[model samples]
Target: MNRRTFILGGLGTLGVLAGGGVLFTQRPEFGRLPRGERLARLEASPHYVNGKFQNLVPVQVMNDQNGENRFVAMAKFLFGDKSHLSPKQVMLSKKTDLQTLNPAEDVVVWLGHSSFFMQLGGYRILIDPVFSPYASPLFFINKAFPGSNVYTAEEMPKIDVLAISHDHWDHLDYPTIMALKPKVKQIVCPLGVGEYFESWGFAREKLHEEDWETEIKLADDLSVHVLPSQHFSGRFLTPNPTLWCGFAFVTPQRKVYYTGDGGYGEHFKAIGQKFGGFDMMLGENGQYNMAWHAIHMLPEETAQAAEDAGAKQLLPAHGGKFALSRHPWQEPYRELTKASRDKNYKLVTPEIGQLAYIDGQKNEQFGPWWENME
Candidate 1:
């Protein structure tokens, strides 16, 4: 084909792909914010600014001094070294049957990469469940590596509380949410997150949308505090219309903290001081790049955050499932294991689906399971 014809054909193909992406985002699974009262509540939040949500401290999404455009940076990351990016063999997991587990046992199980199933204070809580194979509007993008997906929607029992940290596509999965609706008794998410659930036909009463520093009494035995995470939120066309946050699950005796997804910031110290300390802290321990230093934390930073949170033991999540960054999938594990050495908190590295007792086992023996996976 002539150069002119080839260029024309390429442009046409690009147009078609872009159009398909636009339509894909419009699917009901993508979800939308509520208007009227819900919108008013969102606008009233301290984090909500003139038109968008803001982090506790200023965040620089990129630190590009070399004037590299976003498209160029994105392309480089998209096509980075394939050999170190994902495991040749899928990572391993240890199964813990959620349906049969004792709810009174106060155990926590990692469902891979920012997802958790915990029975604390006689309450069953599921956090950021992304059981779907991919973490994108388009199924082909951000596909989970083989063997990473062992638990499915069918294995989950009726959840006492579903704690969603933000509206990110990976975290607020539509297919997973729809599947869990029958089992989710109540959902407590950041301000503006309920709109998405309400759009999906979740009862307005069941949706407890909270702003930063606000306390939510999920039950007589459980109280959840919505706290700040230096992160942004959105799913489809719009961005940051919803607030992103961390959480402190307070029971009569124990406090469990979850750093949803965020960069290392002073908010961690502030939260630590506010709550005194966490018995078990779940930190976001993967998907980091210097390009977006203000959003995600590096492994060293993860260790620091654990110390700042005054955690008795730090249980790392946000890894083991998805390779959302350019780094090797197991890099976070290797780095965090080294960084947490002699730190204030014990670094707890349980294999995905293994039992992590929040209140029962404060000193669970952890080893680098991903050592040979790469």
Candidate 2:
């Protein structure tokens, strides 16, 4: 669901839709589009222009300047050699008991790919959670690698804030969201994304939707800021209807930035300067290609972005779960290990479900666990 066709593919693929007809539209996984007052609020936002929400710097979904086209990209994805795209063995991971964690401690647990469980300022925050086995509407597409889905919604602790970056199938999964709805106390999403939660029976008051650059003060010590990211959003046929964003979790003592999914841009430096630099940065460093480099970043760009954000520690995400792109599954880790050598920030690569403490002077020491896991 990270690619252009995957986003535009809708719930069903072309073959699946060719047979299902209009009944495919009835599926709840497709999610409801913004309408009524919600649509009006989206239209009023400065980011929304013409008919769609645009990035701060105008971005093309595909980089046609690199001699890439949609059809060519689609062909490469569908027919490309994918031998190394997924690990032959199950992914190595930890089984940390999230519920047993101390409330006073601040920590981050990456739930494979872009989903994360973080405890900051004594508040439990879950971002872009996809506990389901698949990232697509269908079970066959974008399936999670073996042993990658170590945590489930039922096992999750009571969530203080469930922040969603976008409406892409991988990030805003319908089944996962429905399962975690009752456990989540409050929901934070980009503009117009509240429509899906409303349609899913969540109370309007529970949803806090904000446009880019707006900050929602949750507590005296903690404030979640909706920031800019160079990405697009869509779960169905229509693209960029809802806003896509990055998030900055700020507290009096610590600061963390999560780049939901984006290419490198000045916004990284802007965010770093805005917050006086971050203690840690969780940015996307996988599922990228030259075909869509304008949207998703490469490993080298990820390192540079981390430096631009002045991050003390950089935790590379958006891999170790699914093969959304044709590159070797562990390429991001290997490339980033080298790319971050001369960078200011320490590149912290933890196994799925392992803890990355954010409160102290010392962080967990992790090795290249993906090295021999073919």
Please give, for residues 277-371, the per-residue lDDT of candidate 2 as tens digits: 88899989999987788889999999999999989999988999988888899899999999999999988888999988875365767899999
Point out where model 1 deviates above 4 Å.
1-22, 65-67, 360-364
Q: Across residues 233-325, which tens digit of lDDT does each residue of candidate 1 receive?
A: 888657798988999999997899999999999999999999998998999989998888899999999999989989988899888888788
Question: Which sections of candidate 2 miss by over 4 Å?
Answer: 1-19, 65-68
* Alpha carbon deviation, residue 143, candidate 1 (Å): 1.1
The 10 consecutive residues of candidate 1 with the worst lDDT sum are: 358-367
> Residue pairs in steric clash, candidate 1?
none
Score candidate 1 by lDDT: 0.87
